[model samples]
Target: MKYFIITGTSRGLGEAMAFKLISPEHQLICISRTKNNDLIAASSHLDYYEFDLQNVNQIEALMEQVFQKINLTNADGVYLINNAAIISPFSRIEQANSQDLMDNLHVNLLAPIVLTSSFIRLTQHLPLEKRILNISSASAKQLLPGMSAYSAAKAGLDAFSSCVGLEQGVESAAVKIVSVYPGMVDTSLQEQARNTSNEALTTPDIFKMVKDRGMLASPAATADKLISFLLGHSFHQGAVVEDLFL
Candidate 1:
């Protein structure tokens, strides 16, 4: 059976992705901020763990406990999706608060790094195929005035994935990694854009682009696309990619 370890599975794209991975043939272990009772009701394959990513320092031990349930020798493959993130307190770099900066870094980037490290270490001797998919954002590449913290975190994730890929290239049976930009989904971004004051966002019109212009992608559709990407092919190296325009 396949094993999927997903973060931020309580809501948004993370929740949708978890739902798709649910099946009698697979086991899904979720690490999120809260319990998803409805999701748990949906499948016996689902296992839930509640812990806020903001407390990034505590994840390693939790992961160790989570990994104990899986027998690597019996699994077909293992996948990790680091998908929890929040864009809050949008502000210019100079105006950013110390605690918020630290929180964003912990949730958006540091958690994934720590999780990936644990996954690698725990499964180092196993023959199982390992894959880590990082949910990335356009904000990483685009210039959004008030998104300094979010942008830097994602950009750092991208660079980290790329470097890990480079290091794994020559090694035999190294884990496959990818940083995917799942275009504007009607996730929290929609609400933030519609609600946040224009003065806060550097590009205030982007809110209109997502909500008013009807450009936001559906979270379920994006999750389907991501699952397809994960299952349809073997990714050899770390890649920064977007959902293909089909």
Candidate 2:
């Protein structure tokens, strides 16, 4: 059976992906800040963890517990999808609060790095396929005025993925890694941006324009494409891609 360890499964694209991946042939271990009753009622082949990712100190223990749910004797492949993120503190760099900045960095950047490190370390000896998919954003490549924290965190994720990809090349059982921009999905992150006051942002119109034109992709559709690319043969290891599934 295939195994999937996914984050932010409480809602949005993560939830959509979880719904699509449910089957007798796959086992899902989902992590989120709160439990989704719908998800619980939908599947018996899944394990749910209501743990916050921002509490980076406890991720190692969490992963230890997560791995215990898998039986390697019957395992076909193990995958880690780091899809949790926060798009808050959407203010000019200097105007943003220090606490918010730290929280943003911790949630969006440090947490994934630590999780990936733990995932690789824990699964390195296993004799099975392993892959890591990091959900990135276009903000990583652009210089948006109010998105410094989010952009930097995503950019760091991309660079970190590249570095990890390089390291994996020398290993006999290298774990594949891909950092992808899942495109402009109609998620809470977009809502937060659209709701932000214009005075706090330099490019506020961009969000407004996207919404006005209905340019955002639905969470279900985006998740469908993302999961297809992730599980398909076209996935290139260590690639930092933008709009690849589109």
Candidate 3:
């Protein structure tokens, strides 16, 4: 049995992942700004928490509550998926306010860092495998005109994951940090981004390229790959992995 913690469970890729991972043998902790009744009702093994990713101050307390509820300790192998994020509408650099940028960082970058830190502290003595997966975007690799802030934040997160992977390896911890690009899945976030701005919008052709040629694999497909990686043979500490595009 595996213990899984997934953020941004209210919708999009997170929601799909939660549903796909639910089974009689696994324990799932779903975290999001809001609770989805369908997800809560679907699995007896599932636990739901409503958390605002933008509120960094409450994360520790929330983690404590989650650990207490799940009876998790250092002995349990834990898998954390930092999947929650804010995308377009607030995507553009010049169009975004300081508050917008901060909000994006709070959820996309800062919250994950804190949560990973807490997880490391909690599992430092555990004998089980510990994994941290950061959901990234193709925008992180290049200059995305309207998605400057989002891209920047994701790039920072990718860098952070790489550094964490290296440091954890040095410490001989079982913790592995992986930054995965989930590609363009069919999600509300994409729909929202498409409708939000007329200027600097990603054309359908670009979206198709992401889905077909880039890493935008289907949510179910990506979830399967992720589960395989998480549950199969263990890897060395601090390994950095990207989901294969092909």
**C-alpha RMSD for every candidate:** 1.6, 1.3, 2.8
**TM-score (C-alpha) between model 3 and the true structure:** 0.87
Top candidate on TM-score is: 2
Q: Pick the lDDT winner.
A: 2
**Candidate 2 lDDT, tens digit per residue, 46-164?**
99999988899999999999998889899989999999999988888888899899989988999999999999998888888899999999899987888989999999999999999
* lDDT (tens digit, per residue) of candidate 3 on 76-106: 5688899999874344456677887788789
Candidate 1, 124-213: lDDT as tens digits? 677777888999887898867888889999999999899888876746578888898888888775577567774745465776666778
Candidate 2 Cα misplacement greater than 4 A, ranges: 170-172
Q: Name every residue pair that clashes in candidate 2.
A: none
Native-to-model Cα distance after best TM-score fit, residue 53 in candidate 1, in Å: 1.3
Candidates in order have lDDT scores of: 0.84, 0.90, 0.76
What TM-scores do the predictions have? 0.94, 0.96, 0.87
